[model samples]
Target: MNKNLIRRTAIVAAAGAASLVLAACGSSDDTSAGQSTPSAVSSAPAAQGQHNAADVAFAKGMIPHHRQAVEMADLAPTRAESAEAKKLADEIKKAQDPEIQTLSGWLTSWGEQVPAEGAMDHSAHGMAGMMTAEEMDKLKDSSGKAFDTAFMEMMIRHHEGAVAMAKTEKADGAFPDAQTMADAIIISQTAEITRMNSLLGKN
Candidate 1:
């Protein structure tokens, strides 16, 4: 009831209200700052299974290996003397080209890099059944029947390497798609290996 006291009380009430408003704003900012964005877990993991580091490495390694096989298969048409050798080479190209495309596509879908041409050194990896540089050179230099024989032999070894790599993928890789591809390589390459052996004898 004193006039000065009434004014003072009104001033104090305004200051307290302003302090409460500031406290509310500070609390809201603290809540916002404390919140975190969700981690990026892959949604397709259940459908394809969990792809780990091994699956990635397997894809990275195998893509180049398959590409080299395609390169060798391409050479067969030019180098083979025998009709059978040429036919086998043509068949190899047909089967492997689609597979190469499929594997490359899978790598892309998985957000992995497709191995560049000549990026991986076959000699350094020392994959079993890989032709040595000297061996490839010999095949390239040969002509006619010599080329046919060498090509069949070299291709058989190459297919064997593919089969080996596929088996590794099947055993170690997590994705169902990778295992399916591995099964295909096993079936196709086994048949090709047998056919190549017969062709070698005939040549």
Candidate 2:
């Protein structure tokens, strides 16, 4: 009878130990799964939302710069004599308008200020390659071949300024999207500058 009692006690202990081991395995699996999920969800938004002061400045300054470029492009359809100049102006307006919207969206999402509509007076900021009021007026006063020549010359200078700003942003900005935009600007504007120079026989 004592032997039977000992055998029964050993079986019960073995069952309890096995149960504990199974429970520990289940708990470990649950913890690992929970940890992986939250990390995956968190990493993406953090990367997307990252920005710094340089990114903000790039967005702000480029807004007016792009707006002024668009304004100049708008004049070309009516005033320019060269077909190439008109086509180039059209392309500039199309590319930059969407970028303006995108930049504004990023600023709004970041709780930053979008540049005001009347902020065309880039002279106050002493922004590079920006036209003076007199220069704009002069362009407005001209037409035909004169308009084409003036537009190409001023745009070349404006594009050079934009390239400079983009280089700064690429080097100093933390936002990935802004950096990508800066790269695009550098490549596209440099090509456009070359094209304009060729059209003007300056190449």
Candidate 3:
């Protein structure tokens, strides 16, 4: 071939190769971008999950409520005259301490502020059936059968409050774990209430 014709053919061949490479790169980039957008969107809802005001209230209110139950249970070992009461106290503390952790963890996962540990200020939490300072003081001062009676009465009321809160959560909360916990509280506390009533009968 002539030198001029050879040079023109080489230029055309190089241009065609460059165009194919550019088109292939753009196709790959477009495919990657298209794949990424749906993945990011699909993951967002799963990450958020189902959270609401009721779940927040349940966790916030119940943590302190459980703490108070633990505190009251601590008094049982020394002050309770009834063996039944002491045993029940141990049960209460065991169940509630871990529950406090579970509830706190939920609050953390939900991006809600967890209640500070050791703070039992439940006033204005819309929590029902909490004992007043005087009532707790009254229980602290009592001992023997008197202590047993007071403790049973107070705990029954306390459990009733917990049941009520759980019922509200079941009705209003959006989180599945929170609702499950709420159902559990209602069942367990109601049974405990029946047992407490029987304990009171012994006194």
Candidate 4:
């Protein structure tokens, strides 16, 4: 071949190789961006459940226990004497009422039998820190400082029970959501218990 023709052929081959290299680099970048897609999904909130027996038990037990707390909180608006006492009661209700619904929703979503609608019929299984009929009656009957003291005493007991249950869920439960909720309960109720203890003049 002529010298000019040979040089032109060489130039054509070099251009093709450069095009292939550029295409390969583009493919590598696409793969790297695709790798990040999974990370984005992982950062999303976890799926709600894969609940185990311990999680169900925690939910069933805590709901009634929380309901009683709400009932007790409701009484505080009328019966509790101290502004601090009443405010605590209101805060308890605010925190627990939504938690009650969240727990019940999880149970239902898991195809578990939610506890009986009201008052947590603990007939089948007893929950910790439940108020006795007599105790609840006394709380309802008492007013002013008497009510304030009774409510705080009872609630401290209630919160202690919740913290215990939450700790168990953290240890034994399988569901991510349940365990997270349990952790939150342990943190919040522990603080509330401390506050109530101070209010009651206890160590």
Candidate 5:
């Protein structure tokens, strides 16, 4: 009878220890699951909201810069001599138009003023590699090979300016999306600049 009692007590103790082990594992799993979700949810808003002055400036400056580029691109279909120039111009418009809207959205969300359509004309002096009124007039009047040559040259300069601005954004901007956009600008414009140089036989 005594031996039987000892065996039964051992079984009960073993069962209790196994249940405690299972409960510990369950508790750890629940804790980890709970921690993961809130961290993910909180991070998204943090990324979206974390903008500094540099990010605001980058967005504002780039909007007008992109607008002027699109304007120049608009001229190419009618004025350019080469098929390549027209295609390149089309690509520029396609890429930048969407980006313009995105930048505007960012500005709106941040409570900053979206630049006016004609702001480039007033702000040209502050921006690098922007064409003056006379230069734009000259481009507008040109046709055939002259237009192609002028377009490529002017675009190369314009792209260089944009790349510089994007580099600054990458270095200083706090907003994650803005920094990403800056990276895209630097990569795309730099590639376009190289392509333009190759087309102009300067490569």
Candidate 6:
């Protein structure tokens, strides 16, 4: 064979081998890309998994309950005669407002309805420590020392009802978020109950 022809054939063979190597590498790259795409999609957080029915009920019920407590707190500054009573009311408002917002956000995120802005049926689920409509009406009418006593007593009962609801949530709720919130309510309200008892000289 001619030397030039031999050199040309060798060069063609080298080019063909290089092309095969590149094709193999391209195929490997395509498989890697395909594998990564599904992994990325699978790792995404699911909205449905984050909430359940128990969480929905807890958020819906708590929002209005918190709002009523806040209303009762707002009444304290004007109606309570004692500085201590006013301070307790302020504390209740400060603590509960954030929790209300938190629970409201949960309801919104879960696509659930917020509770109506009206009187709630405290007896609906056997919730204890709730004041009757008459008691609430009396609290609304009174002022000064009478207001202070009424506010404290009513709030103490309200907190107790909240505790009972929280216990129910802890027992039957499936969502971790609702369970965590229930735990917080139990802790905070228990502490408040102790404080209120001391203030009432019942401790």
C-alpha RMSD for every candidate: 14.9, 12.2, 12.5, 11.9, 12.0, 13.3
| Tens-digit lDDT string for candidate 2 (32-148) | 764465466658888888999999999998999999999999999999998999999998999889989999999999999898895754443589888877888899999999999
| Candidate 1 Cα outliers beyond 4 Å, as residue runs | 1-45, 122-124
Query: Which digits, one per residue and each the tens of the lDDT, describe model 6 over residues 41-78?
Result: 55555533566676776777777777778888888877
Higher-ranked by TM-score: 1 or 3 = 3
* Model 5 error, position 199 (Å): 0.4
Model 3: CA > 4 A from native? 1-48, 122-126
lDDT of 5 by residue, 1-203 (tens): 99999999999999899668666766777877654654676589887789999998888888988988999999999999999999999999999999999999999999999998886645556697787778889999999999999999999999999999999999999999898899999999999999999999999
TM-score of each: 0.70, 0.78, 0.73, 0.76, 0.79, 0.70
Candidate scoring better on lDDT of 3 and 6: 3
The TM-score obtained by model 4 is 0.76
The all-Cα superposition gives candidate 1 an RMSD in Å to the true structure of 14.9
lDDT of 2: 0.90
lDDT score at residue 140, model 3, on the 0-100 scale: 90
Off by over 4 Å in 4: 1-48, 123-125
Question: Model 3: which ten-residue window has the lowest total lDDT?
Answer: 118-127
Please report the TM-score between candidate 6 and the true structure.
0.70
Clashes of 2: 0
Query: Of models 2 and 6, which has the larger lDDT?
Result: 2
Which pairs, if any, clash in model 5? none
Candidate 1, lDDT over the whole model: 0.76
